[model samples]
Target: MKTKAVRLYGKNDLRLEEFELPPIKDDEILAQIISDSICMSSYKAAIQGEDHKRVPKDVSQNPVIIGHEFCGIILEVGDKWKHKFKPGMKFSIQPALNLKENPYAAPGYSFKYIGGSATHIIIPNEVMEQGCLLEYNGDAFFYGSLSEPMSCIIGAFKANYHTESGKYEHKMGIKEGGNMAILAGVGPMGLGAIDYALHADRKPKRLVVTDIDEARIKRAESLYRAEEARKNGVELIYVNTGTVSDPVKYLLDLTGGEGYDDVFVFAPVKAVVEQADKILAKDGCLNFFAGPTNPNFSAELNFYNVHYNSTHIVGTSGGNTEDMIDALRLMSEGRINPASMITHIGGLDCVVETTLHLPEIPGGKKLIYTNISMELTAISDFRKKGETSPLFAALADIVEKNNGLWCLEAERYLLENADKI
Candidate 1:
């Protein structure tokens, strides 16, 4: 059988190409992808083409199907995987490939699961027998792809946010009470951080979000409902970096003359690194949420600032299995309106077209519907059914019932399962 994918052919090149697909291995499963949201790294690949690590020289040499964040339904299953998933079942995939137990540890990108941008994906035996991040939820849409991004965000929160430290230090560990600044372009991941920070259990006292695009900042304010984000004690501040000559000075003023307690650098801009150091409060933490492409991407830091002020800087990449699991729970429960982030929706035909214009598109998530025709549904219907899942309702109840224990527990589950899938 033949499968279609958005393949990276050369530098700044991508095409909708077809390939002969291998039969499902006995321990594997075949999935029909529902939807996929684009990530910044994918955008880089779309732009840099051959220079991108995942895009190999040629099909025979090495080939990669683009896209990482997606959700799908089980279409066919082999014997070894039949017990884990059933046909017609909807589930999210934990996209991180590193498995602690496996000898080869073939992460999906390393092997040939292809990508969510394709019409179909073949789940390898290693991924199947170990079990992927599949939750028994009917309303799950684009879970397979989204699992990776959400998991990565959960990992960031886990790495930074803590409840115990909040009560003792009067800081919310980047959750509710501490001040946070996301300095980078407001791509999808940056937008996710904004939502996560705003709706965080302990929420940040104030969230200072920035981007070079003024339109994206406006969209974040309206779509994420920043006006209504005060319940968690989160104060939303939007800054247009395009106009700001000195972001560091601007951030200090926004934080009552004190610098942000925690700053998340999302874009990897050289200036962002320097400003992050300037705008952090004493004993503050700076997280470079976005990874630099250059292998030797290093930044200069002041030792006096680090030693005397007691500041810390850290970076994180793809999340563990635990993050994906928690992300699923967060989506299932309703604390996060994951679908709300999706602004652009198209199909396989538009992958190359939309990807080419990614940097130009402002704000919200862009979804590529690989399995079905975009003509099958209208935009209005798409938006209407977006939040209709019963899981969202259930999650809303969980949020209301006992604060956010359910949410916290859901995250904890992903951490535990990170190694298994």
Candidate 2:
């Protein structure tokens, strides 16, 4: 089968090209990709190219497909796994396949045959054996693509902290029923963290999300309303730190000088990292959530607190299989909403440029429907644009039916009418 895909050749080189895929082997599965979400890590992979740890060593010789956060439909299932994995089943993958004890050979970054930013892809034997393939029965197909990022947020909360108290180790998660903060860059991932933090089983008493951009802070507040948080018995505060004279002092004052129990640094800026460290309370867990492209990026730390206050730092790149399962389950149960993380939608043809300039684009996740040919549209603009464009008018109807949010009906209508739009 022939399909179009975004392939990485070398550093700063990405090409959207047509290629013929080989027949699926007996142990493999063939899938038609529907929705794939662009990630910042994909931007790093495109720039770093061969230097990226996840990129295959021979990527220059054999160009690999470039995407991982995606969901698709099983087009052809191999005989060996026909019973367990049948054709026409909707599926999402936990692309961080830690197969064969290897951490670097993930689908989007390393695979030459499999990627989300393509019309179709093959599921290797390793992915199935590792049980990374998830059959999704969700309402919205975009949720399948979104589940991967949401899993990362789930893993962050699931991460355990250990403290040494005279030879006894005490382990715990984000201090249950305590104050929490997500610092800087309340973009896509930061907003995901806020949603999870507010709705998880162990909800925070006070959740504070800080961002320098006033518009972004307001957007986040609008989606995850303070009224909703109050209904959940959690105080939610959105702070535009740039407007404040002393941001750290303002954050500290919110907690009545108690400081945050868990501080998640969503920006890789050195100043933001340092600020997160300074606001840590006793036994505070500072999660460096953002990944910096620069290898030598460093920030000053208060080692005195590390020694005396039981404050520590932790960082995680992606979630595990269990975390992905937890994310899917939570979404299925309506405990958390991942759809709010998406801000833009485009087709596979636009993925190359979108991946290149992702950081410059504002709003949340940019969803790409691999089979469609459509321009990127922000969900917020559907209503206004619907006035003139009949296509957007149809979309506006779907979004309104779902309470002004993107849902399965909206995704189905968009995909069915993508070519017309």
Q: lDDT winner among the candidates?
A: 2
Candidate 2: minimum summed lDDT over ten consecutive residues — where?
A: 160-169
In model 1, the Cα lDDT at residue 386 comes to 36
TM-score of 2: 0.95
Q: Write the per-residue lDDT of candidate 1 for residues 1-421, one digit (tens) a residue.
A: 6788877655567677878888987877787776677776777766666555554445335656778776777888898766667898876666555556533233323444557778788877666545554653735465445667867876776666322323544332454477888887366787677766766565778788887777667656665566677766677888886798877777799888888778888877777788888888877788888877677887777779787876778678767776777677776676765544555545677777777677676555666667544422222343244377443344344334542222333223222332210
TM-score of 1: 0.77
| Clash tally for model 1 | 22
Which digits, one per residue and each the tens of the lDDT, describe model 2 over residues 176-271?
788999998478899889889889888789999999988888778878999999999899999888889988899999999999888988999999
Worst 10 residues of 1 by lDDT: 412-421
Off by over 4 Å in 1: 9-13, 46-62, 99-108, 136-140, 161-176, 241-246, 296-298, 360-363, 373-421
Model 2 lDDT at residue 120: 85
